[model samples]
Target: MVNDSLPPNQRRFFLTIILGGLSTALAVVAGWPLFRFLSPDTGGADVEIVEIPRASVDVGGAHFLTYRGRPVVVLQKSAGEFAAFSAVCTHLGCIVKWVSDPGEFLCPCHAGRFSTDGAVLGGPPPKPLEPIPVVLAGDLLRIG
Candidate 1:
C-alpha cells in the first residue's frame, strides 16, 4: 500500500521504479521457458532415411535417382558396394556426368572430375561431392 501521505512526486518515482523492475522480471521469466522449449533439438544420433532401391548400379556407370525430388547419383564401386551422392557439382552448381570410360564423375561445365567415391580428383571443385547416407532396408535402399 502506498501511503497517500507521501508527496505525489516521490510516490510516482517509487511506483515507476517498482513497475519497471516488475515488467523486466516478468519478461525474463516468460522468455526463458519459451526459449528452452523452442530451441532446436540437434542431439540425436539417428540417421534420417531417404528412399532408394536395391538395384545394382554398374561400376564405371552412373544412375540418376531422385530423393525428396532432389537429384542424386548412385555410383557402383569396383568393390561392388553402391555409394550415393548429390549430382550437383560443387563447382558452379552444374550437373555432373558419369564418364564411364575414365570411371569418374565429370562436371562438363568446368572440367571438374570426381572419383567414383565422390572425391574431387581434378579442376575447380574445392571439395568432394556431398554424399547421401544410404542403407539397405530389406530389398530397398534407404537414402538420406
Candidate 2:
C-alpha cells in the first residue's frame, strides 16, 4: 500500500518497484516448469536392446544402422509416426541417401529416387525399398 504521507514522486517510485519485483517473481515461477521440461534427465543406466530413442530421429530425418547384417534406415514421418526400410537400393543394391529437401531417398550410384514410404519416385530403380517391421514402445523404437 502507498503511504499517504509520502510525496507523489516517492509514492510512484515505490509502486513501480513493488510491481516490478512481483512481476519478476511471477515470471520465474511460470518459466520453471518449461525449463525443467527442456533440460536433460541425469539418471538411468544404459539398457541394450534392438531399440533406439525416438528423439534420435528428427522430423523428416532418418536413422541408419545395421539390422540382420544389412544396412537399414528408420525415418520419422511425423510426430510419433515412424517407418523403417532396407537402405539398399532396389535396382543395384547400392545404399540410398536421404534427400530431405526433396523428401526422398536418392541412390548415389544410379540416381534412383524413392519416396519416404519406400515407393519408387524416379530413376532406374526396379521397385520400392523393402520395409522392415517396427514397433513403437513408449520412448523407444523396437525394430526387427
The best candidate in terms of TM-score: 2
Model 1 residue 131 distance off true place after TM-score fit, in angstroms = 1.0
How many backbone clashes does every candidate have?
A: 1, 0
Q: What digit string (tens of lDDT, one per residue) describes model 2 on residues 18-115?
A: 99999999999989998999887543323223688888899989999877667889999888789999999999899999989978899999899999
lDDT of 1: 0.81
Worst 10 residues of 2 by lDDT: 41-50
Model 1, stretches more than 4 Å misplaced?
1-48
- For each candidate in the order shown, give its overall lDDT on alpha carbons: 0.81, 0.88
TM-score, structure 2 vs. true? 0.65
* Backbone clash tally (model 1): 1
Tens-place lDDT digits, model 1, residues 58-135: 655667876655678887665447788999999899999898886889999989999978999999999999998776
